[model samples]
Target: MTFQEITKDEFAQFSRQYSQSFLQTRQMAEMLEKRGYQPYFVGIKQNDELKLAAFMTSLKVFGGLKFELNFGPIGQANEAELASFYKGLKAFVADHQGLELRTYPDSNYRTYDPKGEAIDQPNERAVEQLKSYGFDFVVRHIGFDEQDVVAEWQYIKDLAEISDEETLLKSYNSNAKRNVKKAIKNAVSVRVADFDELDKVEKLIEGTGEKRKFATKDLSYYQELHQAFGDKAEMLLTEVEGKAIAAGVFIEVGSEFLYLYGGSDGAYGKLGGPFLLQHTAMLHALERGLKSYNFYGISGKFDGSDGVLRFKQNFGGYITQKLGEFAYYPSKTKFKLIDILKKITGRK
Candidate 1:
């Protein structure tokens, strides 16, 4: 097998042939590039035929360069192919003198039903192959202290079973159903926000982060995201009496609609504006003939009182546990130094 750099168009064509993560797309890479990361694609070929490809984003930090492969290395690979790809990856890291290469490959996961029943298991051989190539698995939790670039748990609503909005609402928990009704009764309306109105959403997010004591990206980041995603992304704002109360950013890629970000003022909690916003997004996804609506990340613990998890759970979706992130350190000394710094600064 041979590995070579591929153009964005070629990589995109390859990506479309498989179930791909939105993060692996050229648009996402371009967005990250604009944010100061160096984005690139590498394709693995056997007998001159493409077997696998990965989109990687790299950035420079204090210790050395750090690379992140978010929900990527998009393509199905047999054991042999995986081994070959790992070999190429190690060689590339060495050539670039990378401090650490972190990967959150989408393939390394088992799916479970909503009731905590496992319906699938990860590929044992594939996991072994990755470990053989010096990748060390890291356990990740939800929150600011999470070391992984992505969340380990996600909530996915299969839209295929529901035929209409009423049925969808009925599928939710009783409290969710009540909230939806209250939102409509309270005159909360949801509409797609114009690009110029993103500031309203950003401000709402800032307020939420402040109250929740979490960090939020700058306005420019959301601007670039909106531009990069174009029509595939939508900013839905929930309003009461012409005043914005809650907002959500959603992206429809392939057959999936992802709830990427959301924020709301606590004052509007009683009015159920947040619930209305999410419901509207789901309805829009259904109208677009999407297969699933993903509520994105949640704490892996599945605690009932966890506010974020509870909010998403009310929408009625199954849980998907990802295999989590793995790291391959090209320079052990630099990796150790960075680890120490991360601990000291409470960063990952």
Candidate 2:
């Protein structure tokens, strides 16, 4: 197999063979580029047929650069093909004056049933294999944020079993069903926001952040995401009697639809805009023939402390925890220095 950088069209064409998150797409690369990440589409091909591929975002860090494979390197290849791809990827990074090559290879160490019981054994072999390839699996339980890159725990709803909307609504927990109904009965409306209304979307997200005491991305980031994904992205706003109560950014790609970002003002919780907003996203996903609706993050803990987890659970989905993150440092000295600097600067 030969390893080389490919064009966006090549990457997009090959990527259709496997399911991937929006983060692994050229659109996401373009969005991240606005924040200073140089994007590269690297792949391995045999007989001019693509075997393996990764969409990497590079940023200067410390003295060298850091490359991230957000949730991919998507393709159906054997362990041998993967090992060869990893070797090529490391060399490519090193040649580019890279400090580290980080990846989150879309694997799960554990997956839980709806009752929160572990149904799959831990992925010890994949962990060991990655470790053998010089990538250290970093143990972390951080929820999805800029620091975490992606969620370790994701709450996902499967839409395949439902034959109709009634079945889907019946599958929701009582709380969710009631809330969605309440929103409808209250004459609350949920619809896609106009492109110019992105600022309103940002305002709703900011309200959520202030209420929940968390940070939110600037409006420009959300706007850029919408621009990148075009019609595949929707900024949904739920309003009651002409007053906006909640907003969410939903994107559909591959076989999955995601509630990537959301925020709400608590004053109208009784009107159930948040619940209906999510329901609308799921309905759109089902309509698109998507397989799954990703409610996104949760802390890895299943002990039920996370309100976010409870909110997602109300939609009746199983919890999954991916294998998390791995990093290969081409320069051990620089890696250690950066670690020390992070500690000193109080950065995670």
Candidate 3:
């Protein structure tokens, strides 16, 4: 078994065989590279045949090197394969003077109802598999990791169960159905945005970020995503009386159509621009023959306090916690020293 760098296309081809996330795609690799990450498509091979592949990014910060396996190690690997990969990974890190590696590989977690009730409990097999190979659960955060790159907890509507648009709409909660209808009755137009219209799209994003008190990316980020993914990605906008009021960025990658980001003019909340935008994106997902429509991040707190989670639940999708996020320390001593230093400086 060996660890070696492979081409981006090779990594993508291997990953697609599994249920990959948007962050694990070839397009994400390209987009992150453009954002100044040192991208590497590394694969573990046995007998010159691929066993596992991950698109990793190398970061040299806080006086040591770290590798981020954001959402991968894509193919199936048994104990032997994992053992070899970790040994090789340690050697690979040592050669580059790296201290540790972090991975957030998608795997079987669990499913839940729209109301946050557990439908299926989490399976610990994947977590146990990684633990046997030196990957430890981060455990820094209690409930959900706030700094998650992908939605650790996500809401998804499986299109396989739905037959048509009418059925899809009917399956949604009453509030969702009412809001969508209201948007249509109010003459709100929902459509995909052209590349040239990103400036206006970013403006909607900006308004949302401000109103919601969350940081947002600049226009350049959206431009790069559109360029990298082409037709597989889209920015949908909702307009009322010729003025854009809401925007949602959707990516049709892997087996799911993921709602990556959304922005809306809160003043138009009553107009149901957001509802129409979601409905439009879901329609596009159905047209593309995608298996699932992911409404993305939702808080795990199910006691009916989170408005965002409630909004997603209205669409009548189930929630899931993708049991991923593990870290491997190549040299425990070195990793500890850096960890202590960061904490001491209060910069963590």
Candidate 4:
């Protein structure tokens, strides 16, 4: 087996034949490039056939460099092939003199029903295998903050099970049903916004971020995102009386529709524009024959008063807890020093 850097076209062609996350897409690579990260497509070929591949993004840190593999290392290789791939990955990191490599491999740790009962067990064997490769696992409860590479817990609505919109609405909790109705009564209409209307969506996001005390990316980042994904991305906005109140960014990859970002105005809370906007996105996903509509990340801790979790639960979706991030430090001393410096400087 030989490991080599592959072109974007080669990566895209390979990606089409395998199941991968939207983060692994070439468009995502392009977007990351605009954000100061250098993206590379690395692959292992056996007998001149692609075996395992990953989309790696490298960023320069104070001490050395950091490599991030977001929800990736995508391919259907056996255990031996996987071990060989890791070996090559380690060598690649050494060649680059990277301090650390972070990866969030797409693994189903566990699944929960709508009632929050665990319906499936975690893949402990895979976790153990990764640990054997000297990868340190960061076990975090879902949704506290994305201090890790990605969120561990996700809310996913199985659109494939629903026969129609009416059936889907019926699946929602009573509060969600009422809110959707209220939005309709308040004349809150949801529509797909064009690229020109992204500024309005960004404003809505900024407003919500201010209220929630969270940081938001600038308008240019969103513009680059829209340009990269093109039709695969949809910006849904809910409006009342010709004024936008709520908006969300949804990305469709294969059979999955991911609700990536969302925001709304507090003044329109009574109108329930957020709920309507989500419903509109889900409906669009259903119309497009998508199998699942992902509400994305949520805090793992569940309580009635947790508004964010409650809002997602009311939409009637199962919870998916992923195997969290794993890190490989080429030099432990350098990695620790970098971490300490990052903490001292408040750099994330």
Q: TM-score winner among the candidates?
A: 2
Clashes per model (N, Cα, C within 3 A): 0, 0, 0, 0
Error of 4 at 8 (Å): 0.8
lDDT of 4 by residue, 213-249 (tens): 4446678977887899989899888999999999988
Residue pairs in candidate 1 whose N, alpha carbon or C atoms collide under 3 angstroms = none
Worst 10-residue stretch by lDDT in candidate 3?
Answer: 139-148
The model with the greater lDDT, 1 or 4, is 4
Task: Indicate the residue-level lDDT of 311 in model 2.
Answer: 80
The local distance difference test score of each candidate is 0.81, 0.84, 0.80, 0.83
Model 4 spans with C-alpha error above 4 angstroms: 147-149, 213-215, 337-348
Error of 1 at 93 (Å): 1.2
Candidate 1 regions with alpha-carbon error over 4 angstroms: 108-126, 147-149, 213-215, 333-348
Report the lDDT of model 3 for residue 280: 86
TM-score of each: 0.90, 0.94, 0.92, 0.92
- Put down candidate 3 lDDT per residue, 292-324, tens digits, no spaces: 998877656787765668788888777777776
Q: Report the number of backbone clashes for model 3.
A: 0
User: Over the stretch 4-36, how does candidate 1's per-residue lDDT look in tens digits?
Assistant: 888898898998887677788888899888889
Candidate 3 residue pairs that clash: none
Every model's Cα RMSD, please? Answer: 2.9, 2.2, 2.3, 2.3
lDDT for 326 in candidate 4 is 89
Number of clashing residue pairs, candidate 1: 0
